[model samples]
Target: MGRRIGIKDVAAAAGVSATTVSHILNEVEGKRVNPETRQRVLETARELGYAPNGLARGLRLKRSNTIGFVSDQIATTPHAGRIILGAQEEAAKHDLLLLMLNTGGDPELERKEIDLLLQRQVDGVLYASMYHRVVEMPEQLRSVPTVLLDARSNDPGVPSVVPDEVLGGRTAVRELLSHGHRRIGFINNVDDIPATHGRLEGYLRALAEAGLAEDPRLVVTETADAAGGYRAALRLLQAAERPTALFCFADRMAMGVYRAAAELGMSIPADLSVIGFDNQELICDGLYPGLTTVALPHYEMGARAVVQLLALTGAQDQGTGPAAQEMLPCPLVARASVVSPPRL
Candidate 1:
């Protein structure tokens, strides 16, 4: 093997001091090295294959330049790729890497995996959840700079990033209203989760804004599945005054609604308009008259989580203010499903 290239070699080759080479190579801030010298040093370092020892450098800087992405059951979900991709791409922008860990919802395993990450002296962590929900702050994470992705903590002191459930819900309903459907039915999720409540509030808020009153009978809570959606749709459609449009809490529920509509001999868009949430591509694209829906910003959530973590770790100068509870808006994905209601 040839002699290992070092800063001295690059300095000699570039006709500059070792200190000048180090400052330029390490990218130390506030240095006033000449641009010509800096460029020549960089070129010489590349030519000589002079690579700095990342471990030694990290030790000197007291940072690993790596971020830990720890998630529970996210690997098994469809949105996992987008979320991971978002964080990974953003981290790469800062010449950082992401060490991912999936705990499979095991609390003990989570503790152990987190310990492993901490052992590496990671700059910070992104504690992500598969879905939008409230999660308790893990005891192991408190000592480190952390940001919650697609989840929130009860402690307002911790920063978190989540989709704006209320706005998403309102966005879905507004799509229906825009198509001139006033007698709209919202098939909401039965579970008492943030999404369940936020969407409902959005539904009401939209109706109120449009000078319409909330019809208690128009809103029904179901199991948030195809079966539950089918059951609810049957009840709503069988009524003497059936809804002209239906807004489902989830795309899965919309599947049931589609079946219910077919049995009742309703032609979608012509006889009824339907919209769903969660924009699961499989469901949205599989349906005959493709389901128009609201999409959770999974990719954006992951990217923003890193942005927040970078700020917390003082790696980036982004306000980094105390405990930001950021909420991103869910955008509408238009497909073949939504249209103006049938003429009376």
Candidate 2:
């Protein structure tokens, strides 16, 4: 490979000193350089296809201007792509670059990835999980400015930004209750996952407020994917006392619920009303008869997380404590998938 062009090359091409080039490229705050100088340096850099050695520059300035983003899963899921888009947009606004790492949901791999980012000297780190669950990050990361998105960590050192899953769950139940459906069923992969558990808590809370005791049989806990929801819906419909309405934890599971209802020759809303979370656009628009869902604001969450992370890192640079945690609210988007319960 050819040797990479450096600032020196640009300075020579622009007929200016290296210091001038540096000041123009870094764009020092509160230090105004001549606009003509800035334009000349930029033109020279472009003409020479000059790329700064970010790692070397970071070492000299004691700042990487790069943030590490580690996610539990992204390669296989379309969800991760959206989060990335949001993060990239925010990073651009702050003139920062992102170094992405995927752990494939392995804790050990996550630990290694964190170490690698630290070695590269990132300004901060953001850990995101595809599913809402408790994560055990590397102990070495205690010194790093870290934030989490879409999941919570027991380690207080790391602040988090997660979807208000509990509120989303509450919204689902309330919508059904408002439609006069008391006998509502819940479908979740597990009651153990933080996101699932929080949502379930909201569901129970809503039921209690309505003066309804939870029927154990109406709550279906299985795997979190489409297959899990499919089987759970089958059991719910086959029960001697079937629920008039169902709230699925994910859009994927809602797909399963739709299938089961169809196989049983049940018409939506008229015979069985359904609700789901995650408000994924494709699932919401592509459902056989459409699906009512709770909008997650996932892209917005991702963007905000990166922006907050930069603020925290800036604080630390000024010899201050880490920034406080940020929590964003979830909003519900209504679509056609629910109706009033059948009259006795």
Candidate 3:
């Protein structure tokens, strides 16, 4: 409806050269502009409603300034909202937009969509997985700067952001141990993912740190679901020397554990102490007395993946070195489920 305000317009209004305005607006690293001048240019640009022409900038810089988010079944994930929200908010801070595509696990569709994104000149791409696991980067994505989300690769050259599974598992066990739980059991997932193996290592590490010998029978692998949790809990609790506490690999499995505990006439944190991972609030909060658990850094993972991608594409410094695999720590979310074990 009106003539667009350009950088030159803001520069003229702010009594500075267009180059100065460009440096301030583009946030070119190592450019020394006075803070007062920067503030004035920003204020003037805001007042004049000046918006850079994305097309002109992209053509000149040979970059779209947009990222491609390619995911498989991310929508079906309960924590997907938080992950997307984190990425979107962080990208906005860098003045970048994400072009999203969900391929529904169709490899052909994924490749085609990625090619379409490349055609649009996206500066980079985030190849996201619904859960933390190992994934091979697609051939089409190799042509562009890419980062994996909640996933890792066999190739160290591929950058990624995932949760520190070992640390997370150790954290959960340490919490239980702090409450005087030495005779503990682990309800693990049978899947051969990083989480499955890393968490098991963490469990063993924490036990050793406490000078407790490993009891091979205490760690049981199940299907990572409520039914599996129920089955695992029954086996552990029915033993001659039942565990005083149990750490579940997932909240859903913890739900089944609750069911088993009830059937066995066990009161949580009284007859048995319980903890879980993933911190799925619906399961954690809905359970009576709540469920103390270790929370996966879903939002942080998304944000960090963008940082890795930005580094890969040379979009931002992010004060980091060469793009490499990064793992964020999972923190403890405390509730009412875990406490000192019952005096046997």
Candidate 4:
């Protein structure tokens, strides 16, 4: 291709100085120029195909029109890819670019990535995780406008956008209860994770709300995987008076539950109702009977983090406020996995 056109070319074509061209094209605030001259400069630039240099413009304005997106395993996971897509789409809407870097859960690599992003003078930083948990922010990240996605920071000044796990847990139980299930079993994930605690709280809350006594024998905690689910489900189903319905902490766990049910010669929704969290289509839709589950709202959390970061950076007109800890809602996705308990 021929030599690319620049602002100097536009200036020459419009018979105006390069400074005047810069002022008109960049819309430098508080600078006054004749309307006809402004129109002429714009038309000439367009005709010449002149494009502004993002790096140079950012240097001059002391603000980069770029966002640094740092994630720990989220980029590599197929289930959470929508989070990146949502952030990218929202950034484009504001005419900004996203520079993504995945650290694969390496703290040293994460620090290096943040240093590189800061060197580029990114306007803001978005720290995301594959799952919702508390994150320790790197010292370098504290200097810039930053927001946490599907995670929380120890620093109260940093804002976070995550799904409401407690609400999700309650919704899952309510769905089972609505189907006339009085005896329910909860197959929980490991006890240390924040989600485990929150979900258990919701389960207890829902049972209390319905005037049902908590059954100690009905609750079991195991690893957050299919094997764990299988073992837990076996124990729950083998009891003399087994629960008519089961609520799993995650979709993967629910898949294990399905296996256990099949082994016991039980059909889903007919013999035993089941519900799961995380509307992972791979597991939920692929099951013999589509698994009813709750969605984590990954996309909404990603999109809202960008919006909130922009507000923190004064890039948007939304009112400024104290650091926000926003929890987006998790909506239930109904499917064939849940039904009324079978009558004796």
Q: Which candidate is the best by lDDT?
A: 1
Best TM-score among the predictions, by candidate number: 4
A best-first ranking of the candidates according to their lDDT comes to 1, 3, 4, 2
TM-score of each: 0.85, 0.83, 0.84, 0.87
> 25-144, model 4: which lDDT tens digit per residue?
989999999999999999998888888887787888898889999998965566567898888888989988899988999988988888999999999999998888998877898888
Q: How many clashes in candidate 4? A: 0
As a TM-score, model 4 comes out at 0.87
- Cα lDDT tens digits, model 1, 33-77, are 999899899889998999998999899888899999999997568
After TM-score superposition, the amount by which residue 61's alpha carbon in candidate 2 deviates from its true location, in angstroms, is 2.0
Lowest-lDDT window of 10 residues in candidate 3? 314-323
Point out where model 3 deviates above 4 Å: 1-53, 315-321
**TM-score of predicted model 1?**
0.85
Check candidate 2 and list the clashing pairs.
Answer: none
- Candidate order by decreasing TM-score: 4, 1, 3, 2
lDDT of 2 by residue, 1-344 (tens): 59788888888888889988988887767767788988999988988888767677788998888888888778776678778888888988988888999988777777777888999888888788775667766677777877787777776667777777778788899999999998999998675776777889889999998999988998989887788899999999999989999999988899889989999998887999999888887888899678998977678878988877877876776887664556566677778899898775
lDDT of 3 at 177: 96
Q: How many backbone clashes does candidate 2 have?
A: 0
| lDDT tens readout by residue for model 3, 154-195 | 899889999999999999999999999999999999998999
